[model samples]
Target: MFQLGKTIVSEDILEKEFVCNLSACKGACCVDGDAGAPLTKEETKILEQIFPKVKPFLRPEGIAAIEAQGTWRVGTDQDLETPLIDEKDCAYVIFDGSTALCGIEQAYNQGVLDWKKPVSCHLYPIRVKDFTEFAAVNYDRWDICDDACSLGKELQVPVYQFVKEALIRRFGEDWFSELETVAAQYQKSPRRR
Candidate 1:
């Protein structure tokens, strides 16, 4: 692990290639997980506030689920997460034909809400585990993202490169720049395959 400021980043983050092949995966990551997307304590409040603006973009079923459950709920692991429907799909998840998408993001795209989707969802394949002193950042390997891995490898995009904007959003520009320098040096070492 490489330490940047207070964050611990996994080497897989620099080695693993992972661009989201949405057509191949059909946005399964949003729907297949046991728990809803992880949320910050502040994100829960943002979800509640933006639900009204995002409601118009969501499906009736999703809306009903949110109404029945709160905007977000504590998962089995006690992590705060978006509420799920039927204990499976995210309550805010909407479908466009066969592809699942975030309704909250749709609203954000339309400038309806200031906050986009949760950082956890935005920073897919990169899950952050926040501790008292620091946050552990690691790549999440799941069968559902095999296509993404293949596509990322084909395109020669590392996980950090693929999730650049999200990383910058979660961390900061300086941190990302440092990571890029570290990644460049790491790639030249021939130490890891």
Candidate 2:
């Protein structure tokens, strides 16, 4: 088992996993207006610079929801207090009574994006968090199981590398050093029940 400030977690809990399909999910994580997933100040700056370019693609309610929530940090519950957009599903999701389309992804592919948004936006269903110990959020619990939604199935990308880069970008080298210590411990002894 892996320990995070006295909290022991089981690594095998999510050893093998997949991505989530928005088509099947209500997109609660994105549209529920949760506040805990707040972006850092640097992220906010990047978003402000890039959001304007993709404004048209974003659903008006989605934009408003983000603004209402204000800024938040990773691994905290601060952002959960924000009000949900439709209460029925994610505001940015467009359902034609069948498959759901992500407006943000469409806009990005159309070359309308300004800045590199957080991986969270593009890497839905696979949430990587830097808590006392690193862990992936289980999207299945939310009933978001679809072949298209499985992140592991589509790309064999290295999650640790992505997280390291993201942390370096947000908190710089020093923060990464601290993270490495925790990561090393996790590698030595993965969490168990």
Per-model TM against the reference? 0.97, 0.49
Q: Measured by TM-score, how close is model 1 to the native structure?
A: 0.97
Q: State the lDDT of candidate 1 residue by residue for 1-193, as single tens digits.
A: 9999999999999999999999999999878979989999999998888888999998888888899988999989999999888988899889999999999999888888878799999999999999999999999999999999999999999999999999999999999999999998898886865
Q: Please provide, for model 2 over 1-193, each residue's C-alpha lDDT reduced to its tens digit, 9 standing for 90 to 100.
A: 4443423433432343444445555454554443323344465555556655655775677667556643222334543222235443344444345555555455767878644445555444334454554543322233444443356446632233334454355446874565457655555663522
Q: Give each model's whole-structure lDDT.
A: 0.92, 0.46
Question: What is residue 78's positional error in candidate 2, in angstroms?
Answer: 1.8
| Clashes (N, CA, C under 3 Å) per candidate | 0, 16
- Report residue 25 deviation for candidate 1 (angstroms): 0.8
Error of 1 at 7 (Å): 0.8
Which pairs clash in model 1?
A: none
